[model samples]
Target: MSTTALPDIRAARDERVVGALALALAASLVVQNAAVAWAAAPSYAAPMTEVLAFHAEHRGAVAIAVGLEALNLPLLLGFLAGLRGLVEQRGGAGAVWSRLALAAGAVLSAAFGLYAVLWIGTVLVADGLTGPTPLLELVWQLHAAAFAFVLSALGTTLVAAALTTHAGRLTAPWQRWLGLVGGGLMLAAGAASLPIADGSSLLFVGMPGYAAWLVWLLATGVRLVRRAA
Candidate 1:
């Protein structure tokens, strides 16, 4: 490794940076839950719930969670860039795969980012219309984008593990296993929504599962960075 590369690895391992990133991700997760709550709350409940129901009745309201989901994209892109630096510095044969992982990460991020923007725009345009669930409008495409994000994240982590040297190893089997389980939970959450005709019922599983996955990702990333340091 080049003398300069040491600092780059060390930066990737920085405790404070990692912690801040975790907080950011956690906040995004919070927004995701808020979106779900906004959807699931009854229309005749208290002031807060009623307000949420009002928003839920509109397309713009659904955009809130999508906006939160987009927030992860830029941060993930930066994380992948850091990983790329570390992989290149190591000059390992796994570097090729690491690069591929980074590409996957970028693709995943971009896909979600675009989803967020497009749907938010759709919501804004269709704000007060009492028509069919705009969700069903691009349902399959949105689901595919979401699935790609989950799978790409898993692929990225696997390649990161493969590329890390002994000195750079920042993850353990427990963490890896938790990640696998988290991904599975997210998949289940998505699948569970398929049969639910009610938007509220679908939000119950899908929203919380997504939040759980984000929390897991944030926590694991922090642990790995701290361990590396």
Candidate 2:
């Protein structure tokens, strides 16, 4: 290969790697959600007795979910770093947005870490108790709050990433619009975090937003991989 052709080869390799990272991140998220669903953990509004019983009886399931959540944090960071590199290399506009995405993704990962830790703590404490305790309830509530914060951070990351890619002409208009709408809903839900942690119905608003984000990740990953090929 000519020396001049080296850059193209390297760029293609970068795209493939980044695309794989995105796909891996998306898959981790899917598996985490499935584990959570399988656990069937009680809602924040559940009675303390019920919450305590569920945690104690289903410790293994919840533990699996927490483990998957822990795995997701690094995957998320890796995806964010790779995506930011791609945006910067494309070198058109939205560099600021790319930076915002990285910042928000960092926050998201931190929130996820805290959330996982809280869940683990809940399971441990609940298992050792015969009945519901104030401390256990508090920990569970904090976990809910942490999850709300994660949604907020995730919304910001999605919006910034969508804008960055769109500005660089790397994604379609529909993806941008979806991100804007979905992110807006997530932000709205997160803004009501206090109420949500107290068991407000507002938490449901972020569900569709989260789903939209997953779709965006899958589509973006496929697009990048195909382009590289």
Candidate 3:
């Protein structure tokens, strides 16, 4: 197949898998978020505590968190592949933005993965496997950096996808709207990550935006697949 045709082929195959990956990722995200959200509950103690508090308290949930978190690696790879597939086949402003956005997402995903690992390390330390360390604090700093870049990617991709269409027209107002809303949410989320050191409660405010971005990403993937088809 020609180079241009290759992405379409990949996109065709990816269309069969991206939705499934999205579902799995979303499920994992919900579980992960639930754990975080639960710990943030007013009834819960350890207001000054980090995520280690939650993992240590709910051991079962910790297993769930770790399991769900582990699944993200493959899902993220698949997402990046799908984005690449779109770009290789389409090769337009939309595709370029999508690639950058996916790159940002990948960075944030990696940072989150590192954060989970740090949490696990803290657990190990509490279990007497290691010494006390500032792993969690380091994870938070990485989180801030990852979120900043991810926000930029989100905004660029959303706008690019909104303005360009397969038909080569500046149509698809809904796509544009998704871009604006999703982009806005990411920026808000990035801002929220900054003040997180002051209090964990502020993280709660960022959740809705991330949640919206997830929804928008799923929708955008589906739209890309349909357009390619």
Candidate 4:
């Protein structure tokens, strides 16, 4: 007698596996944020020269930060995949948002990658690139601008995904609300970053937005693990 074909290995559902991946995504993001903190990236108030000096002195650390961020992109993509799959199952008007969220997530990640590349270049050439190179300044400004654009897209993703998932009881009440707030903050930060890429006070809004994202990611990851358990 012929044996039945084994279930498709790739298609197999293992709650723990998915849950762990989700948690890993959260941890990766935490580390990425921490790397930025470790680098002590200069704020808008600091003169560009000081910023350049700081990066020059901390080239090694900045490189490490870039590596850490590069790692986060894959982790984030995986997490978003899980989320998109879950939300897709709950077909409705809200489901449309899930689709949008998936697209937006891709765009957001790409924007971040661009920022990482430019930052690495800026740090690596700090020694050779002399004072007030307009090209360098332009790249720096564009990187910030790209982040602003992507952050708004990210906010759209989060908001849409949160609304869709809540409809299907994928998230708790508080988490759902928190996700909305987080999304709103991200959108606001993006708007602020759009016109104020010069590293001004308004860019500080992105800090809270970034914090909100961390909180949501951790909370969502924990909830997934709990539910899977």
**lDDT of the candidates, in the order given:** 0.52, 0.85, 0.54, 0.70
Best candidate according to TM-score: 2
Per-residue accuracy of model 3 over 1-229 as CA lDDT, tens digit each: 6898886576666655655565566667777769756755221113325444544566665566767778876776676556555455544545655556566666656666666665555455444222224664454345444544445454544444344332233234565566566666656655655455434454444445566656655665565446446
* Residue 75 lDDT in candidate 4: 72
- Return the TM-score for each candidate structure: 0.58, 0.95, 0.64, 0.85
State model 1's lDDT. 0.52
Candidate whose lDDT is highest = 2
Score candidate 2 by lDDT: 0.85
Can you tell me which runs of candidate 2 are displaced by over 4 Å? none
Mark the regions of model 3 whose C-alpha exceeds 4 Å error after superposition: 1-11, 35-46, 49-53, 91-93, 125-172, 192-194, 200-202, 221-229
Residue 51 miss distance in model 4 (angstroms): 1.2
By lDDT rank, best first, the candidates go 2, 4, 3, 1
Ranking by TM-score: 2, 4, 3, 1
Q: Could you tell which candidate, 2 or 3, scores higher by TM-score? A: 2
CA lDDT, candidate 3, residue 211:
62
Output the better candidate (2/4) by TM-score.
2
Show the colliding residue pairs in model 2. none
For model 2, residues 136-163, the per-residue Cα lDDT tens digits are 9899889889889988999999999899
Clashes of each: 0, 0, 0, 0
